[model samples]
Target chain A: MAYLILKDLLLQRNMMLLAFAYVLLFAFAFQSMGDEGQLVAIISMVGYMFVMVGGAWEEKNNSDTLWNSMPAPKWKIVGAKYLAIPVYVAFVTLVYAVVSSAISLLQIPITTAPINVFVAALGTIGVFVAASLYYPVYFAFGYTKSRYWHFILIFGIVALSSMLPNLFPEKPAWIDPLFEKLPKLTGDAMFLVVAICFVALLVAVSFLLSLRFYGRREF
Target chain B: MESILELRNVVKNFTGFKINGISFSLEPGYIMGFIGANGSGKTTTIKLIMNLLHLEMGEIKVFGLDSRQHEQQIKQRIGFVYDDNHFYEELTITQMTKVLAPFYKKWDWNTYNRYIHRFGLPSNKKIKTFSRGMKMKYALAVALSHKAELLIMDEPTSGLDPIVRSEILDILSEVILDERCSVLFSSHITSDLDRIADYVTLIHNGTILFSTSKEELFEKYSLVKGERSLLGENLRPYLVGYRESQFGFEGLVTDKAAVQAMLNGNALLERPTLEDIMLYCTRGRAV
Candidate 1:
């Protein structure tokens, strides 16, 4: 598994470097503007791409049917991609913490909470959501073949989802009272539990689906 | 009788087309050639044996273990070299070598280094820059580096230069020197198989045409060339298929003694090469 990750990292070294740069620049921009949410989103997107490309390499698009012919099972193959996501998230989070911490100490409006844990936890949440949405699609169609279109499609999904509350007409007046009180009862706990459940379900389903698709695909 | 790999009544259906009941078994120490035309199931069978694709209906056993039940364990004992080369395009050969070596338990750096020298592959070069032959050499080198008891390859020499192709065949010959190791080589290039294969399994339209010893195929089947009018219905049972052109008729005849006797004092019966046999066997299916 380590070799698989290392091979894929080396395979996409330039893209990885570029992704890091993208996150760094985006983090700098958002942190400088005191916008932590957008910074987390950018870092999350970068990690998602890393796992997506990893999935593509595992499936082997440009090359011949070499990896597909290797004797590993469908679960181990999908498991490799999932394992890489958190590692990439950790790396990106560490980098963001370093740069953003400096900005926070300078009174640049960045939060000064117990830095490592808070940053890692928040970045992991974003990683979880983005991966939950992206992995199922990426596994459905092996990565390189669908990266561009799915990236665009995922953006549309994110945009439409974010706009739903504003776009949809108002719910009943009594419903607002429940919506307001719901946050009081749960707050981040609800979000965390829901996100964890959804991500777990998505990852499991993607793997099962990938295995089925792979069994039917020829070299 | 311990066979390294055995396929029994393997049937895979792809929508309208089908691979029906293709069966063959490779003895422990002999190299078996898998030959077929374009639409034949050479690669598909390899995939099924490798368990890359699910077997629709059949039983496959590898090293006495059920292919589906112990797929990975069987895989660990076998090395596969598919037609296309796949390594990290961005990684230099050095990086690829280091990263891929640890996956197999029997990985040998010394053997890998030897193959690199034997194939004349550069460790510093990125795989993306290597020529087709070079890439193939690297893939073969990796496949051989691990101490695998079985080697299953699909068209290991199809597009390579003759020099490299010959080198791969030589390597396979050496690999088969061990009494425990065997190979299942799938190829369209019958000449390569003819030169190295101990047995031959010919597949056509997803069906096994013949699975017999290479020497037996050459000895039993003879290619007869003569005038169409000179040939008669009496030879129909022996004729696998025939091509009738403006000049005359040519085809494959399985019974060498009968073919020679039938054309006595007339035409001639010559031993058919693997190519000649495959050509005639697949003649009717070309359209």
Candidate 2:
């Protein structure tokens, strides 16, 4: 599994450099806008790009057939791919933090927050969820065949999220209390605990689903 | 005899083609040549044995272990080489080795290096820079370095110069000299199999035509050529893939002795080659 992950990393090593350069550019551009939260989005987007690039490289090279022929269980191969998501997210976050810190030390007038671990964790979680949703579908249909489905998924989520509020302009009476109480719950430490558990469960289920799809796939 | 690989009544189906219930086995200390035409299910059968493709029916066992239930364990002892290169093309040979070496328990760096040196492969060169033959040599080096008990190669000699093909055949012969290792090689190049194979399994249109010792196959089939006037109605039933030209008629006959008796000095009977057998059995004229 470690070797498989290492292989993916090596194949996508160029992405790291690209991500670093992108981070530097975005940081410099958004520094004047005074938006620090965009750094998290940048990191998340880079992480997402790594997953797609890795999948594309694998498909182009037909590495899945090679990996399937190796002495590893099919589930382990799929598990390694899922495991790479967090590893990549962490690497992207690290590069962003480093670039942001260098800009701060040079006396640039950027809105540099001191690398909040909580925000980074949240960003990683968000990217992981998105990847988890995408990768299982990618594995099921492969890169070329899954592109339209991926477009549909992204657009469907965007459409649904944007339409829900317009359709229900009058907040339901039952939902107002829950929305009112949500911030109070988020401020409590136990909320972080619950969030972590939920994210972990989602990731676990996603891994199992990807594994099931990958196991049935023929090279 | 200890069987190293066994397939029993194996069946796989696609939309228009099916690998119909084929069964064959290879014993240790010998090479089995899997002979078939293009799209004749050779690669498909190899994929099935590797469990890359799911089996619709029947079972495959490698080293007496079920291919599916114990795939990792079974694969640990098996080495595979495909017709096309399957490694990372952008990575150098050394980098590719680093990625793949740790997967097998018995990988020997010295053995790999020895092959690298012998094959004249540049360690620092990217695979995309290597020619087709060089890539195949690299694949063979990797396959051999793993101390694999069974070597399964699919059309490894397909598109190579004759000299390079001969070199590969020589290396395959050397690999099988270990006595504990066996090879299941598939190719349309029957000449290569003629040089190295001990057992032959011929498949055509998703069916096994014959699986027997190479010597026995030669003994059973004969290439008979005679004057066109001698090809009578009486000999029509015995002729396979009979071809007629302005000068004579030639075809493959299974019962060489009986055919010779019937012809009685009118026809010239020669030992049938693997190519002759494959062509006659698969696409030969019936009468």
All candidates: DockQ: 0.50, 0.80
What is the DockQ score, from 0 to 1, of model 1? Answer: 0.50
Error of 1 at A147 (Å): 4.5
Model 2 regions lying over 4 Å from their true place: A25-36, A101-114, A160-165, A168-170, A179-189
> How would you encode candidate 2's per-residue C-alpha lDDT over A13-35 as one tens digit per residue?
78888887877776766565344
What CAPRI grade goes to candidate 2? high
| Residue A151 miss distance in model 1 (angstroms) | 4.4
Q: List the residue pairs that clash in candidate 2.
A: B241-B284, B241-B285
Residue A88 of model 2 has an lDDT of 92
Model 2 DockQ vs. reference: 0.80
Residue A204 alpha-carbon offset, candidate 2, angstroms? 0.6
Which residues of candidate 1, in runs, are more than 4 Å off?
A28-33, A56-65, A97-116, A144-153, A168-219, B244-248, B284-287
